[model samples]
Target: MWACKNEGEDARLYQAVKACSEFAISLGINIPTGKDSLSMKQKYKDGEVIAPGTVIISAAGHCDDITAVVEPVLRKSGGAIYYINLSGDRYKLGGSSFAQILNKVGTETPDILDAGQFKTTFNTLQELIKAGKVQAGHDIGSGGLITTLLELCFADRNLGASLDLSALGDQDIIETLFAENIGIVFQADASAEAILKANGVVYHQIGTVNETAQLTVKNASGNWSFDIDHLRDVWFKTSYLLDEKQSGPVKAKERFDNYKNHVLNYSFPLNFDGKKPVIDAAKPRPKAAVLREKGSNSERELANAMYLAGFDVKDVHMTDLISGRETLEDIQFIGAVGGFSNSDVLGSAKGWAGAFLYNEKAKQALTNFFKREDTLSVGVCNGCQLFVELGLINEDHEEKPKMLHNDSAKHESIFTSLTIQENNSVMLSTLAGSTLGVWVSHGEGKFHLPYAEDQYHIVSKYAYETYPANPNGSDYNTAMISDQTGRHLVMMPHIERSLFQWHWANYPEGRKDEVSPWMEAFVNAREWIEKLAK
Candidate 1:
């Protein structure tokens, strides 16, 4: 095992040796020890090579850096080195610093998954395997538990297994789908006693393999079984097929007319005198001035433009609804505007999500409205975060969209360019074959999804600059995404504010373009609403 000492090296080196010694003792390996050099000499004298078949754990710089040095040495001696890399003190696993990273990653800090714990586990597994203790090993990675189990089944090939997952800490289906912990692996051996004796880390035997090709899972309550072949088939199928069923060629004129009627005929009740309720005529009314709040200038402007294109607009505080004053279904369109709401506590948009989720009436109302296809919703910036939290969109599966932190680890407020993908979406059809310029301002805005086979698709994306350039590290460079139904549009940037000429970011570029392409998309939406009124 190769070790190095840099600044503050001696203490770390001593800790590493102590851990290795404990691991060795756990495996029932006896080693003569005294000073550091004395122990090294004793190991060499006891028929152990100083270079190979030895597990070298270090925190010298990059884990890969140490691996490069140790691999050759181990190979030359006809052995392998298992390198365990530590990012920081193992005890700091669930501290606030780690929680902040999780917040940035747009995921709740997992209670059971810890990086340091997994690193220790990996090192132990490797040591056990090297000592001829385990027959096979598997690493835990993306797709969380589901992917891990599937890979294990593939590796075993023809050998089925039953898992008693009662010992696992997390039981939530969604949590099991996306939890990511590095360096953890599962291994098995023929001789259970020998494997136990060689164990250098903590592990539990959940179950054993059998002759069948079925993967059976047993919880505290009962058993569930699935065929590996069937699982693999479903797992590999493309998700794009969900939108494969064509709605036939869309009659842009006819559909627009229908949308206009749908909006105009939709009756909305309003409490105008602050007491008595009255029915408001649903018509292609001019977009009303939006009530101002922090970061709402853009949304208000967009709503006003939509009014110009002909649509009713209103501004209601999210908190006002919580007072049992009005229901979401009462409104024709719910505009979730941008800005840091509730101080972005418990994760961005978490407060809004919590409010919605806890309100049974509101949840059912939104669900029924969508089921009836009567309501249109738009989420921008912080609003986008709320949509994911409320589960209004991205409901194809149990997975929820997570808005990860920016790669720069800072809030970037600037104007970026985006392009719309041509697809069979009512929303995307308006912006087909066109590029859009919009303003983006947020920290936790990066998007990530599990690496599942055919589970998701990127409908539209932002260009790096004005062409195909990507500014943020968004998945597929996605600036805007929609659900399969195309009823909900969630965008990270603020298009509403970019409606006016003065708000254009390229104003100083000497560009002759007055209104941004994004404003055009909003215009298209208004035109669609107008046609619906007819």
Candidate 2:
């Protein structure tokens, strides 16, 4: 998709489109969709402001294998870092980030000299990724090669590299370091070297990884070293400043201080094999109802996960229950999906909960289901809010758990780590003592517990107890909760969204299975229901 914002300049717009069309024709590809906003000039009494003509290209494509993809992080055990310049040795500084910072735009600009070579290099990198040969990969863009090398170090823990750019044999050291040359830099092993050689793609082994979190460079001018941590903090300071405006100073400071300290350290179950155990086909799959409200969006994901875990899934919209079209009579399991139910304008799940409380049929149906001995239920995000509002988990207690606004004062949409604590939750008990990554996207997700910690069945807690990682400032870093009986569960994060390994932001290396460990939760629920049925 192409999105253009341009001043009233038809000739410039035509030229831009013509250039793109010519490039697409050369590549034998077609951009079938686009949008344009020609009105970009603002007339002022003093002076007129004309926005620069821009065309943003957005393309979506399928990858060969998501599991094989490498992050732009310099690993601790990283080998040599190599560079494959697609700019064909033309290190143009014009229209580059370096020029922008220097308050100058030079005459000549960087361009894709050879499209065929570019395609070959792209495909070669993809092949190396799929073959599990490349440990890390980064593109030399924006800030050029120096920035790329430093960024790789910035992403990982205590990782740095020494790169000698003297091999480039460029007369100008500034051009060699700062020029906007279209290129690829990667950390690879010996096996990758063999394949890279076979591909006949010109690549230079430029650097070696080091344990010290500092970057060292060697060029024609001289040797230079930089403290990676200090530079990273300098880069992050801007982010913290920006965050302070939105997340509040206190929350932003908390995040800034704790982000590096609170690393994602996972611990899996001793018995988790990452393989699905075969279940008997003779028995009928247990019925599970995926509950959703007006603005709910994660219902289909919940339903699919349930189906994968040996349950016959059914979609149950709030309207169905409210109108008495479908009662919670047949469904053994209930999965309340995560989303902004009723647009969350009513504050969290107040509007959603009101629909059930005001309507006799919906209220009675839900009440009956919870009251039943054989039924199991799980609510997530907005659904979690609704469940707390209705006092479903601790209906007996006068002061029930309350869902409040996040500590950040905004919706916390993050993929963070959670550790499964020892609990009797029918769906999640099997995964106790395990730490996993889950998606959290919500505004009012914090749990305000008036009672003692032991009173509520806490199933999972955020691995990090600080801001951002904890996402919502829930009591005791509580990520998930269950009832006294362990039949009903509620969580702020979306486990259904993290059903597959590919869904994870950063999965454990060497685990090749399609299904992630979170799938065990649904499986356990299915097994529990089957045993109860028997």
Candidate 3:
């Protein structure tokens, strides 16, 4: 809140506060949190500069189920666009972006004339959302009705809309399309219309999602066509210009040039239902260890994933191994969780590797664990660096592989895809030929492979072989690799982070699955150990 000085000609600051209070009271909303600088009027050498007061509101609503929340992305087929004006006010352009651009501020401005109606509309929409009716949704804001319609088509690939602004009445063409009003434009199928009408919700069937990538806008004036791709690129240009300033010209353009070309494409295993398998409580749970150093933060997530996969997960810190407090004797599976171990001061997992390479007890425990025929290990992010540094995964190679800084020389954090190849890894063998989305976040995740690709048991490759999708640009586009025995593995992607349905960047609709396919890895590990024990 930039509350200007109250010593103005008409006490503008006091009036703003009064207006805000009245609106909130009418809406039954509280102004519980806000900070203000009421003394922003600066006194110059000659005169004073009375800055205009500005107040912006940040509203948050609680979600019962985040997965059920409606998205703003349009589906390819089976949806009709609808609009309901919640603002109960006349179309107004005063103080709007259009008016400001033209330097013409009219007397009246757009607002929610009926707060009760607005709330009713919101609650009605929530009911529709809970009923799985809302396909896509976007609010009408500054740039007005037409702009909001265009934005809904921009998010998805090859999506377009055939718009008909006729139902809004024979109002002025400019006012009907560009006037800023408080409303929402949503996409839903025919079944939702009865529920909306039963509640006496005022709505208009505006358009439908088209197959070809083109926006057909029809008004009383004329019919107009727009290229969605061209508009999307134009929309992204402003952000790209700012990115160029921070990330430099080359990298920014490389990102801008390829950001929209690659949408996430995934292929699941033939029988991989996204449901948590029912575990028999009477059976013994498998034992697994989640190893961590001081700065590690991902152990809890990894441990939770293992526990859910019918394993008794233990958090084993480096201190425990160094002090000989916890040996790998009872542990069947070990996971080196991802994080900045030792704050990654020396490099990614350099300090972590030193503890095992130099310390006798820690080194012996790890060596003995690797030697055990019953044990299995997998490393992620910094842990991947640790395994490479210690030459644990590639013991056969005299010149061991290394983990290096990403080709971008920046920390890459992305929810991306990994195509699991045909591999004999005990944990990943069943998941072969499956393309899954997982989280990848690390700076030095790039694999500097010294040996031939055929020599290593390459388990996974990235779905997209370019900058952000490939993330670290590992050799041969490798996202993960396993030892020849398939007993041990190292990868940059975090399967633990992507265990649930909400973890994915874009998931298939109507799934209602409790877990994502990434949970298969942990389940596979647990089952493998269980079978071996039998």
Candidate 4:
């Protein structure tokens, strides 16, 4: 008969009471309740007079409520009263509804048990509780099962119980050790044999309660047990701080400093010359005319390779170039790196296009330069979208093509296999008869191209194919698509990231022969540009 101010609080009270009742019923203990106050009082007095081992589980509701009512009656009856106050941190069960909240935050499924298995296990447990055979049941809960088991052994005065965990099909040992569930408790001296006979319940008799305050477990292989007092001393009080003191603080600080320096100063090998050598050129390298944006790791790597292949690179921001201070005639190859530009809002590529279009002077310069084919403008990932939005590729309408959200409705960064289309376009011509493996990390990367009925037929003139094919659910399985002229290529995937063997799929052991083809593609593109320059 617990009263609460609101329905939510009432629900919590009901759950607490129901859990206590279930635990009592499993132990073959009965509690009396009645509408009349006198009858309830008489039942309490009789139970107290009987001198049975009674435990009253109550939530802290109104400071002196339990002390005023049940405390006196239990004291007179010569029984001990245990009060359980429900005021502490509350963690959601691993298999409960609250687990979905973690999925939204991390975008990864955390539960080891699938929905079907969880439902099956829950249903079986419910049915077993309904029958009178199960004398006591405990929910596997916080600090997980290990802590719960230790607490149980402590409470029962060093009584150990055998647990058969074999019924948990195909689950990892670590997962079982830390799984959580609320409203569950372990019951001592329950009808273990009858409980096992029930449908879908599998358990093992592993060990028993002892008088010496020790816990022991006997699995199929062997027996291993520990004294509770010794375990507490070793686990609770043992400290690693003493060892740290022996090592000395100055030595630790020096070691940590060295580690940080090693990480920051590390440089990868650019050439396969057997010996790792620092890339320091004697004379000043010729600088490329094009203004390059501050590149990411991938962009920087590609730019370095371009420098090796004889191209001048000047890193500049978009704002600096749009001020009319940077001229296009001086630049041979204008390169933009692959990254989430302008936060990838209003669809990918759209933002970059808007920035370029809104700038009157920059737009005029780009239009004049692009028409002459003197400047080779390249964009990657969101940068690719920028090229599309600016009408670098000939489009029927002024509106830019759209890149939609991934069909999976989640962001998945992974490597996929890709086959090149052998169209006569400048981009694909270099990639003909070759396949590539590239890394992709993007949410909105679906590419759409306009097609006409009579002018460019769907099957023949229009090239629409998906592949390392259609990772982001693009309309035509398009990993990369080019404009009609084939001079400007816009691709959503990041080829620069996959430049090294470490970035390749199944490197070292698997696909050992698969060197990143995108590196060669860039070099080849550079060679083509060099030829065009001549």
What digit string (tens of lDDT, one per residue) describes model 1 on residues 361-471? 555555665675644566788888888777666786677778887654556676656666764444455566555556788878877765452455455676542211343
Error of 2 at 254 (Å): 0.8
Query: If both were scored by TM-score, which would come out higher, candidate 2 or candidate 4?
Result: 2
Best-to-worst order by TM-score is 2, 3, 4, 1
Q: How high is the lDDT of residue 123 in model 1?
A: 59
Q: List the candidates' TM-scores in order.
A: 0.43, 0.93, 0.93, 0.44
> How would you encode candidate 3's per-residue C-alpha lDDT over 375-438 as one tens digit per residue?
8898988888888889999898999989998877778888888899999898899999998889
Model 3 misplaced regions, further than 4 Å = 43-48, 99-108
RMSD of 1: 24.7
Q: In what order do the candidates fall by lDDT, top score first?
A: 2, 3, 1, 4
lDDT of 2 by residue, 282-337 (tens): 97999999889889988888998888899988899989999999898999999888
Better of 1 and 3 by lDDT: 3
Which lDDT tens digits does candidate 4 get at residues 358-439? 8876677667767766445556666766776665654655554666766544453756555565544443455554555566
Worst 10 residues of 3 by lDDT: 1-10
Model 4 sits at a Cα RMSD from the real structure of 24.3
User: Which prediction has more favorable lDDT, 3 or 4?
Assistant: 3
